[model samples]
Target: MKIANQISMKEIAKLCDVSVATVSRVINNNGRFSEETRKKVLDTIEKYQYNTNTVAKALRMKKSNTIGIIVPDISNEFFSTIVHGVESFFFEKGFSTIICNTGKSKEKEKVYLKTLDSKMVDGLICISGQEEIEASLLSRNIPIVTMDRRPKMTNNLAIIESDHSQGGYLATKHLIEKGCKNIIILTKKNRLSPDIDRMEGYKEALTEYGIPFTLQSIVETTDHPKGNFEAAREAIRQELESGRTFDGVFATNDWIALGVVKALSDFGKKVPDDVKVVGFDDITIVKYIETPLTTIRHDVEKLAEVTSKLFYQLLTEKDVLIKQKHIKIPVELIARKTT
Candidate 1:
């Protein structure tokens, strides 16, 4: 076929002696087509190199075959690992992902959610740090799945989270078993379930060991993901300046734990020998720290696997029944030099 101008699907259909819809079906590999007709369309496409506008086609079909992912921070190892897991699964399923980092800002989160909704994404995978967005998400019947922390429980919603309470207990109990008492916790002040649950677990462990829980022992830090490092450093510095004594420290995440270790080092204190430190979320780099951190491990790969599987069932299977909206993955203790 000889072409004088830029070719479109319409021109290809004309050359193939078929309707535009038939050419579209052949192009998208959807619907039924006779073998002979398929050959003709393909031949014409090859000869002219007719280009199809995917955006227009998606608009016409009302499906973009793309999933939007919203995360609090992409720089954090724990959340980034989860994103990697999501991308691996969706890549195998032939779906594209659009990742948005909110940086734990409610305004940015709302904007991203609204934009994703407007873009007509196939589904949403959210590691939501913003609590207010839950009500609006629940109002619509969307195929949305949340990971890590969630705001509220809804019947149709699917949530994937770690066993934070168990992780907290494990981390705290490990410090106590190392013969350290007067333990302090450095955690986020946010209402996110993970932080709160972890604190509760810390308390449970303390109570079990006949150690009294004191409000002064809990230090609240910035809710921003990256801000947590500095928050931990500042909190520990202030506690030390106040002459408050803490033989052990439990950090909600590895970053905060690192901060605690650093601050303690600045004050001429040795880890495990002076003040034992334990962290949650056994991020990869934790093992390489100067003093390898004793931390709690939650499998990000498993979280990604279950989340993608549940979302796929909701997206494809009409009769698929999800009996539970909230699912918790178990956590394990990884003992290292710090504890």
Candidate 2:
């Protein structure tokens, strides 16, 4: 009786008098299909109430229409927004997502990968977690996409990342243009790809403008967005106590940038007049904040769209030479009150 209750895609296709692939396209709302055909299939689906357990169907057929997403911290607005973008695409394509939060722990990331592997997830979308272990997973023929960070191994991997170095260059260049000297930067201690590339861009800009770069000018935060407010506050407090002077500040991410703003406010300093600030990843909240942040903007939706298309192609197409190895999205500088 339980077996009889389970309906498959093939059954729907047969009932609708259409090819299984055509039915799949209609179900996923992909490609071109005649309106009459779409209505015919949807009506049949409505009549039979033919809801398939995608997981069980996938397991029986040796294909899981599901993917694993590993992120450093889901609470962070940047990562959360990106996850939303990825999920939206996958959901529209009749796939389920298993999201895991690692809290920036490599061990936790490894454990999650193992769990996902056992479940036979079709692919993985990793957002800036463990590198070495991820490379190992790729070696075992896992279809993986890395976002906001590059995987250590490039062979047969798809990377969706922003031009962080260009973003950093733009932010620092803006501060230099504002006639501000003695600029400081807030970043992560572990030096993830985003941090490392942004720092490089910052240094490049300073060098171009003939401003000397100092080691003391760079301060490391907790690398996690949740703790960054207090981290920035403390860093600023120490700098103030030690009488360090700076007229400009650049943050690796928007959260750290907001932290810098709050720290400056606590010190009774005025933005632009005392310390002009610029940030990376123009997350939504920054625009509505007390002082709208000046930031580098990259489209999360576009990144997800590209990633989803590539993943689908890899899953469907056996032609290895036709795939793109890397995708780097551009960044734009948004000038606002903070700058």
Candidate 3:
């Protein structure tokens, strides 16, 4: 006989002869559970007309089932992709995501942190940003996952990022193989992990090839609110006026590469014929640009997938964080017309 009244997960678990967690796994379509167990739980839930009151469940469990994401700029394709991937993963697991665009401001990041804390977010995901997150937030009982950004708290739950050092080395090495010497670096000035690692790789390649790393070989630009193009373009132009000669340029990002290309064009320089160029971040537009970019492809989707999986594991299995994990997702170098 079908039960007229609604029942709790405990009742469903008892009727299905399984644990409440198994019932929850079937309900959320998450975690591990046998197909036979799933069928039995569903059948029982249906027979009893079980109602899932998310609010009530959360109150009892002290889990809001909500996540917070902090990013430097949502407008940036890289940060946006990371946000989307994380949001999509959590949404599939019956959770809501609150994305905060900090505009690279430390003040805004702190404000957002306080807001997330007040809202009782179950977890937090931070993308690569310049500022360090406070130790208090990292010390919370909840899991914290960072992408390409290191938290001040050394023992934070997880840090998933691309292998930027390898990417930088590969980009530089490719330019070297293309017979381009006296290579220059066009990069942003933030000095973040990604930037530092990429530079490290670039230097490594130069060292192995018997090339000297000189201060004059580096040209730094800023991330203007609008874009980095104008800044990169202007910076390159200034470098040209200073009579700094280079047979190759390794831009840390594709947009900056575009600016570099435009700058070189203004000086009547031919790419590949006169100067070879390599860039990092194989964004979609790189393939369609006037000169296709030879660059490193950072796997945003894979980073998000790994970060979310690690977070969920930590959330469900409390003891999983016995050791801190810093996972680096591999990157690939895509050769194009630029090289």
Candidate 4:
């Protein structure tokens, strides 16, 4: 069959000696066709190297078989694990995933959201950094599934997050049970939902034990590698210089906890002996560290799976999804050599 710059269904139908309707039915797999006729139409399509315009198909169907996922940092083990789960689930359902890394920046998040929207993604899964952007997302009326963080403004949004407050409380309580009285929570000052909830949990544990909570004990740092390490080192140095003794330490995330471990090791302090350490997220790095870290584990992969399922339900079964709001996943404490 001779091919033109633009191949139409008519040309394909003529080559197959069939009506255009038969060709259309074969192309869409709509309305039944015999195996032999379907084979002939497909053979003609392949011979002419015909490609259906997906954009037009999507316009007609009112859907694009694509979903967008936005995370704070793709390189982080927690986010990467979640992405792996989401990708696996969606790919099996014949959907493609578009990944966007916000790098913990609000502007970058906005840009990516807009870009994904422009690309006409069917749905979005956001692991948000900024709580303030929830209103903007809600206004767009796009079905959004949030992981690890929940938006403050809307109750209609679907959220999938680990029980972070319980995780913090469990971590602190474990350290205290190890005979550590003076404990400090090293975390960021930002009022992000997860941080705030974890801080509350830390304080709750202290209050239950009748231990005095002091603002001085909370060492806040920028959520970056250099800044977090500097904060950990400086906090340890300052405590030592001031003759203040701390027997237990809770770093909000594993990255900071690893830094704390390094600082303590440099200062000749033995983990779970001189001082007990506990971290969150239980990132892969913590397990293989010099002092295998005892940390709170958030089921990031499960979170992603549930989030993807919710989004799929929303896109496919709309009325049934109306009641969905917050989905709280559980956390676990993995005890290792650190504590």
Write down the TM-score for model 2: 0.79
Off by over 4 Å in 1: 1-62, 134-140, 153-155, 222-226
- TM-score of predicted model 1? 0.80
Question: What's the residue-level lDDT of 149 in candidate 2?
Answer: 71
Lowest lDDT sum, 10 consecutive residues, model 1, at 132-141
lDDT of 2 by residue, 1-339 (tens): 124356676887888889999877665444578988877776666556435445334434547888899988898777888888888888988888999999889888988887786566777888876655455543136577788677667655788788888999999999999998888888878777778889999999999999999898798775344587677777777787788889999998887888888888988999978899998888889999879999999877777778778877776676555346577888899999998
Worst 10 residues of 4 by lDDT: 132-141
TM-score of each: 0.80, 0.79, 0.80, 0.80
How much is 148 displaced in model 3, in angstroms? 0.9
Q: What is the lDDT of candidate 1?
A: 0.81
For 163-211, candidate 1 gives per-residue lDDT tens digits of: 8999989888888899988899998777577888899999999999999
Per model, how many backbone clashes are there? 0, 0, 0, 0
Window of ten residues with lowest summed lDDT in model 2: 50-59
Q: Candidate 1, after superposition: displacement of residue 256 in Å?
A: 1.2
TM-score of 4: 0.80
Candidate 4 lDDT over residue span 87-128, tens digit each: 899999999999998888988888887677655577788885
- Cα shift from native, residue 94, model 3 (Å): 1.3
